[model samples]
Target: MTVGPKARRSGLPARDRRVTTRRVREDQRERSVRADVPTGGGDVGVATDAEAARVQEREALRLAHRVVDLAEDRKASDIVLLAVAGMTTLTDYFVICSGGSERQLGAIAEGISEGLKQDGYLPIGREGSPDAHWLLLDFGAVIVHVMAWPERDYYGLEKLWSEAPLLLRIQ
Candidate 1:
């Protein structure tokens, strides 16, 4: 049994209800639906869903760092991360790091290659060799390049793709 305003009109309560109805109507009239609707959470600038995604990418980079640390820890030298923006913007980031010797470079490349594979990342392709002074591991979202120090300098990947976003740098 709903109480109609006519049935219970003491005066104050009915007026209050009318005021609330009017305010709601006014709000609806003023509000416009946005084209870019937010998904899953708050606004991106305000520590919401987008920020959380960036944090996740950072964590992924940290996992990549384990590969870097493994290289450094194994006596390899000079870790470099490069971001390569894809031709169609499909691939957003890249990582290029290097080691000391050809053997160590191979080890570093193998570590990154295996590590990324175990983490469920399939490389598009990989090239070069530890003995060849450079090794490339191509994960779709990011690429890992392991090179000897001199070869890294000679190619200068850092300068080549300098405009891409640098997500992490482990010296």
Candidate 2:
């Protein structure tokens, strides 16, 4: 039988020919494996678009809850979670809560930042002033608003996002 140039030059015996063929087949098999499979490098499981959206929604909801819990822990009141996944492209969830005073608002924001930091999450942007009536923390998938009662009432976020479903409310 005719062997390839490398094999012919190596002058390998018949026994070695069988080993080389097996090695070549193994290499081909490895190369042909699907790319979707996770390679244990922190990649989540492969999913279709719909599945990916659902996963993101689930994660957003979890983050929203975490924000609510942190705010509540800091004595924030009138906590509300709005699921704006389908209604708005800006963010998946909106976590709205009220702080009694400017000091409380700062405390609430700090609590949220420290809490989310434990999960390796940092806000992409923070708007409004901690000393002001409203402070917003944007975490990409979730946006948290720590507002004073008057500001929340005047801004009417609930009215603006009325079409969005209310996922959770903590009085």
Candidate 3:
């Protein structure tokens, strides 16, 4: 039953009906714009350079910690995490660990790769080789070094980047 304003004024009985009005005004969609560049002038959603850098730092640290955890799961020895963000522009963190042997080095590298992949992250590049007694997994924000005992001692990464803050170390 319908009861429109005009229907009651006409002294007519209400009738069952269904009606939908047309969009006579011709609706138009608003144009899209970047939030960082506000047209009306507002301070919302605009991050300063320092704020953006801090966010990046947090993400890099998280990735580094996860890599260290994965290496531990693979029984990697002498695991050391270095914060090289201030020292270099190459990567934010460096996770160096000893795998004891060439086979173990491969395992450690594979474990970190597999673990991070589950979280939707994959190494941007890989360098060296398992047979070479070392492997490098480049995850952009984090760089992992899976090295054999001899290689790790010879490379002396800790000595090379001694200035970089040692964030974590697990013997």
Candidate 4:
């Protein structure tokens, strides 16, 4: 005599026959792994976009200080950091400073450029010269402008980039 399917299964008892919730979850997890489901950053466990941004910003702040230190070392007359609303694509912060004369301005600009380089940031562009009244350094996330006192007064960049956040002001 052959035992029926239900009768044979019932011999094991209902409690033993049921699958545990933990086992079901494990099966689903295994299936997900086999399917190559997205876990955001894959196996290496890298930072997400927001975390990366925070790190970038922190680095930028460090660079900014380095630039300031270089300027101070080179004897720049005044240093200002502006968070202009819309001036350039790179930095949320703008560093503007002045020197006693055209020659001083050029030296200050050069020093800031070098300092930024030490921090692993390079200026995309620069303008003006020692003979001219002003010099500009355009790092991707921070822009530094060095100008002679007279030129700074005449151009009034602070007024031009009026919408900026105004992080620092020094005369």
Top lDDT model: 2
Badly placed stretches (over 4 Å) of model 4 are 1-44, 85-88
Clash pairs (backbone) in predicted model 1: 80-96, 80-97, 82-96
Which digits, one per residue and each the tens of the lDDT, describe model 4 over residues 1-171? 112356354565445434343354344222222232224556544445665555556656666667777888898867887765266655657788888877788788878877767765556667778788878776655678888888889999888888777776555
TM-score, each model? 0.55, 0.72, 0.72, 0.66
The Cα error of candidate 4 at residue 142, in Å, is: 0.6
Worst 10 residues of 3 by lDDT: 22-31
Query: How well is each residue in 76-121 modelled by candidate 1, as lDDT tens digits?
Result: 5556554444332434355567676777777777766676678655
Tens-digit per-residue lDDT, 84-149, candidate 3: 988887787999998767788889999999999998776766888899998999887789998887
lDDT of each: 0.59, 0.80, 0.77, 0.67
Task: Tell me how far the alpha carbon of residue 156 in candidate 1 is from the true structure, in angstroms, after superposition.
Answer: 0.9
What tens-digit string does per-residue lDDT give for candidate 2 at 1-171?
224565575579867876776665444323213224343576856655555555556666788898988989999999999988788767779999998889999999999999999987767667888678899988877899999999899999999999999989999
Judge candidate 1 at residue 11 and give its lDDT: 48
Residue 68 accuracy (lDDT) in model 4: 71
| Candidate 3 ranges with C-alpha deviation above 4 Å | 1-46
